[model samples]
Target chain A: MRTKYLVGFLVIMAAIAYLAWGGLGKSLVYYVLPSEYADNPQKYQGKRVRLGGLVKEGSVQFNPKTLQLKFIITDGVVEIPVEHEGTPPELFKDNQGVVVEGKFAGKVFHGDNLLIKHSESYKPPQQGAKLKPEEVRKLLEEAK
Target chain B: MGNSKRKLTDSLSSFLLLVGFLVFLIGQYLAFKAPPDVQQGYLVRILYVHVGAAWTAYLAFIVAAVYAILYLWKQNPSYDRLSAASAEIGLLFMALTLFGGMMWARPTWGVYWTWEPKLTTSAILTAFYVGYFLLRQAIEDPEFRAKAAAAAAILGVVNIPINYMSVYWWRSIHQTATFDIVNRKLHMDPSMVLPMLIDLAAINILFVAFLRMKGAIAARAAAREEIYD
Candidate 1:
């Protein structure tokens, strides 16, 4: 009976190893965005993936040699340089929100397909919008 | 039911589990490294392990549900053991599912956790099974344990369909099933799927093998205690 346990434990340990190691190669998800891809291009080049973030105001650059590209993607915190080889979306411009698909090749987005996303539009208060100062004044008068 | 029968079950489970784990390792080696995908590169390789674990876990849950029903109907302790074993294993792989998911999510979705249907429903199922285990822990009576677990098993099984339909039923962060686990996609590339299927089958057999081993042990312990009394 203990043999069953010994065997089961060994087997499960092996299975756990297999489960974690069974992939053809390492497939850890990237916690960092384009900037990381740039900082460590060697680590991320030629990987298949989908990356999401906003487009930088003016960082899209296309290279002729490898159909390569350079752009900046920001998560509102950090901006990452992106590179791709394919044609970009119509709205894919600096400062536009975007998600890029493709692999990284040394500090470039190597984007194969560009998916353009627009920020949600909110209407500003009407031009004639008024604020009642009476409530504020009453509170002030009470304080006095 | 007999001692010898129980012993046979134990031997079989251990042996099978060993074999299953080894095969899974082989599948991973073949699918992951040497021949990187020419198109999408290493990222495409994630499909192999991710899909394998997902399918294997699903199979375990279905098996647990079936065994749960059988145990309830027949009042068989063996059935209860099988149901319990399957649930335990199912919970483990379900965890793997969540881990693998986050690994993929950061790269694909650009976020670690999302309230997506597949992720959310999977999380809920994980919680449900945890509750099942907790329920078992609180109850000392085998009959009551089996009854409560069975009821929970049936009710909890609904989450599987909910998980599958999440992308369709609601806008979710998860992608739709482009390549079903069984059906091989041409673009998916044979180099990848080959090891995946093997790993999946290996895991399946291993799960059953484990179910039998642990189940038999529990069954025997309960029986021996009753005999002593």
Candidate 2:
């Protein structure tokens, strides 16, 4: 009886190991750089892929009414046009590292999800950029 | 002698527990008072607790692995109990880290969880410990159980460094280490450092306190079991 139970335990553990590794095998590369996709655009043409790069300067256009955001993501060598339908994260800005998950619609990448890839370094807002007490209160009031 | 030693440990653990909680409150105050991040604003505060819990979990797993090695070498039941206690606390802290991380991720990464390398490795690390407990539950014989558990504990520790280094080694959504120990450099700003350090100290002290208390309880249970046997 003990041997039987031990066998059952081993079998269950083996099954779990298989499933965990099998799932991980597919998503090993979390996101691909724009340059990487440019290298083999054929592979990711129809399939959904996470395109990651820095948001291009002076390319961001957001329509608050329609909730549509369009921007260009570039890796200095390759640039991909992105069309996302949602509010971007507060950290989202020009030259900011971003990952857009979606499929390509012809030339544009229609993003279903947008994420900010922030750096490890953090600093306080510069001296003049610091929010005044009155402005903080006004912002709080607006939030309310 | 044993009774005196037990009393000493009891007081020591209690002292640590008291200090840990007090310092945690102080850490929270400092974290809030610290200037908001240039990018993340208030969201950056979540990392103070998250990183602290993560580091404590790593420390606990390392301690468990060390105790497991000691238990195997000396064949000591006390060492096994201590190892088990440390692993248990480590698992609890790892859970906290995961929960806090998810909360941080939702706002920052736009997803609660992803199959990124750091998150995936952390999930694997947690699974190993869960398996450790399950293996412990399955074994009936005390000697066999301790031996198997010790081996598992030691083996499970192999994932710690891998999990910590996953962000650097692979393409990850998660940021790299704030405290880059390998290069002996702190990546974060000066103002942000003190509060995070305080949080780290608070969590580690609490881990030690909890381990001591849990170890004592396990020792008592073992003693009671011996009497019944």
lDDT of 2 by residue, B126-162 (tens): 8778777777777879889899999999998888998
In order of listing, the candidates' clash counts read 16, 0
Give the docking tier of candidate 2: acceptable
Q: Pick the lDDT winner.
A: 2
CA displacement after TM-score superposition, residue A107 of candidate 2 (Å): 2.0
Please list the C-alpha lDDT of all candidates, in the order they appear.
0.65, 0.88
Candidate 2 ranges with C-alpha deviation above 4 Å: A1-20, A128-144, B1-9
Candidate 2: residue pairs that collide: none
Report lDDT (Cα) of residue B217, candidate 1.
72
Model 2, residue A3: what's the lDDT?
60
- lDDT (Cα, tens digit) per residue for candidate 1, span A36-77: 554656766677755667777767676555766678788776
B122 Cα displacement, candidate 2 (Å): 0.5
DockQ of each: 0.02, 0.47
